[model samples]
Target: MDGHRIRVGTASWTDPSLIQCKRFYPPGCTSAEGRLRYYADKFPLVEVDSSYYALPSARNAHAWVERTPDDFAFNLKAFRLFTGHQTPAKALPKDVQQALAGHFAVKKNLYYKDTPAEIRDLLWHRFENAVRPLREAGKLRALHFQFAPWVTRSARAQDHILECQRRLAGYHLAVEFRHRSWFEGDAAGDTLAFERAHDLTHVVVDEPQGFENSIPTVWAVTSPKLAILRLHGRNAATWNIGGEAASDRFNYDYSDAELGALVAPLRETASLAGETHAIFNNNYGDQGQRNAATLQALLDGA
Candidate 1:
């Protein structure tokens, strides 16, 4: 592995399925602080999935910093609205919600374009301030922006991606595209080039393919600072299913052989970047936790 670091962990630590399964955590570890402490003791890295649905608060960020070790790292998912997702009006902060109430009188969902420039600026400020503690503590890795499936490869979509980077100028950003157009045919090279030019880390995804949103595993590292490999499992049947919980959609458990096959590519990615993070997103019961542990062991043994 040379001298580069490779941190392996699951995307979420507080998924209901993980807690309800009662397999990974000990008997007394029920509270948020206890669970975080326990999880940090086992893995050096974690991805904050909760930040995706709602904006993260500085208080929670401070609590996270206090609970984890100095060397621990966290990759936070960008808020849904910023990633071109259809966000519910209720997900906004109380003040923002009140301000948007009139605009959202008839609609339940809100898109990025639906917001005024001032509101967008306020959101960007709040998001940056909220994660300031993590950055100050040196525990912040990157903000993962998993764009919506509709954000295809086009000049406008590309501009929106660049705008995200511009808004959070100093922060490290990692991008994951759900639209196949970004990686289809010759466009893959162009996509990587854009990411490289902008110093954006390309999130290498491993998931079910053949669907409209499915993207092949692109092993190239666009940034030298960090590289992220997210495993979303191979559950093709559930990939595009609507009205299902995320746990149900990503329910496939990876076999040992399948995990073993990824060792070399993960190591190669680690060799190129300053740090490599392997995040398991198959949060079905204790599936992600178990797979992460097994993969970590396999990486160590190999």
Candidate 2:
């Protein structure tokens, strides 16, 4: 199944309870194990994102491997190490801070806005360790080290991905770029070249918000044998207008017709380009699941 994969999937890493369904669902999703079963029975690949926030116990991971089938795969997003600012700097050693300061000077705490060396080290350990059960089960697809728009095209960013390869040597890696600077078009060729050289997957996103780019688009540069699509739904108006746009979180949804149009292009693109894994991300409500079903139907030519 190396090159023949054209997977249409979903991005509900947790469940209704954790995201928007909390109000309507009331009780909450049973457990991670249960949610895995629920989605695995539906989508072929899932984009697990909680690991980007907290490391999971291997025990929990083992259950994930056991629950899903072979045709299915879980593409995980790298945690604080890749998203460095998520780690708390004050909690790190002075030596770690000093070393990181050499690269990131004038840093405050590591958790929210600063990316320190200490945080990177900690994230490396957890990221490498997180692959155990998935590898054992042969269910791990690739690790997505997505960066924010704030991460300008610095030598450090390239070096960070290089260093991360050392930590994630055996597992597959995917990188999602969120900055407009990445699209100097030909200028970003080195980044894509690096990914190809290492067999790393590049994330392609469909978002409609935030800082204007000559291309306001973020995520949509796929080249690896494997592709991950996050259809963050075209809620462009709400995302740009004052009230809802001012909200803290992402708000997106896909309509039946929109999902209908998405599959053929995706499948056709992957068939011509390479292998692809597309996941629906209208996690606004119980809509993720419904939209997922819609995409699956379109893929099946239903």
Candidate 3:
């Protein structure tokens, strides 16, 4: 069915607010394994947000493969350092921390540029190895690189993106640009062309606009293999606020009317790519899951 081609899901199943709300998971599904198992039964796809904060372990990946169904797929967010974000030293493995200490005084935060070539190579290797289980199991969909807001459309930034593709040679790479510079004027065409040339999937995002980092919604499909639609809600007031949790920043419940408006364009996107994944990122409580389910129903019924 056409509905099968368009997978709908949330950014993560284990968000703190999602668990605390006590609306989604059952009482018996308290354990991590039980939660994942239960979540997989409801959603065919899930984006791993935790991997962005810390490098995922091979053991954990293996467990994920074991717990989920054969047809289930996972899209993992690239680690913060990999996506040009300031990563804390503690986020790295102990061995990597020691290695960084040998090169220079360990700082509170580290950037990709701050690390030496050897350290960078080591990280790339570890990241690949850690997620090998998912790749082998045919459950890995894409490695999402949501670049920092400061990463503008420049030769240097483009080079870094290309380098990432080169490192993860076999994996599907989904690129999400936060800065509007990437889609401004003539740069939009250039950016899309670059992604197509390198076989990178350009992630189309729905979020608050008017900010320097806010990118306009571009519906063009760069990769034939996959097209991603990420809805981050329209919470303009919370877009820039740094709260104790992610819910504070992404707190907006998408109304049914709002979701109905997206049906036609989303179907068009699905037609362009082999598969289209619409992932809700408004992760306050059960908002994402509820929205995703509603969107799925709308698409199927349409």
Every model: Cα RMSD to truth: 1.2, 5.0, 1.6
Candidate 1: worst 10 consecutive residues by lDDT? Answer: 1-10
- Candidate 1, after superposition: displacement of residue 180 in Å? 0.4
- The deviation in Å at residue 223 for candidate 2 is 4.8
Question: lDDT by residue for model 3 over 53-158, one digit each (tens)?
Answer: 9999899999999999998989999999999998877889998888787544736788999888998999999999998899999999899999999999999999
TM-scores of the candidates in the order shown:
0.98, 0.78, 0.97
Better of 1 and 2 by lDDT: 1
Model 1 agreement with the true structure over 1-302: per-residue lDDT tens digits:
23579999999899998999999999999999999999999999999999999999999999999999999999999999999999887789999989888888988888999898999999999999999999999999999999999989999988999999999988999999999999999999999999999999999999999987989999999999999999999999889888737999999999999999999999988989999999999999999999999999999998
- The alpha-carbon deviation from the true structure for residue 93 of candidate 3, after best TM-score superposition, in angstroms, is 0.6
lDDT, candidate 3, equals: 0.92
The digit string of per-residue lDDT tens for model 2 on 1-302 reads: 66746777766556443354553233545676666776688778887766765665577677778888877788877765465534544434466656667544554445433554556567567557756788778777777787755666678877777777787777777877767676566746766676767666766677774544222332333454577676666666554454422222345657777777676667765764456777766566656666777777777773
lDDT of 1: 0.94
lDDT of each: 0.94, 0.64, 0.92
Off by over 4 Å in 3: 1-4, 102-106
TM-score of 2: 0.78
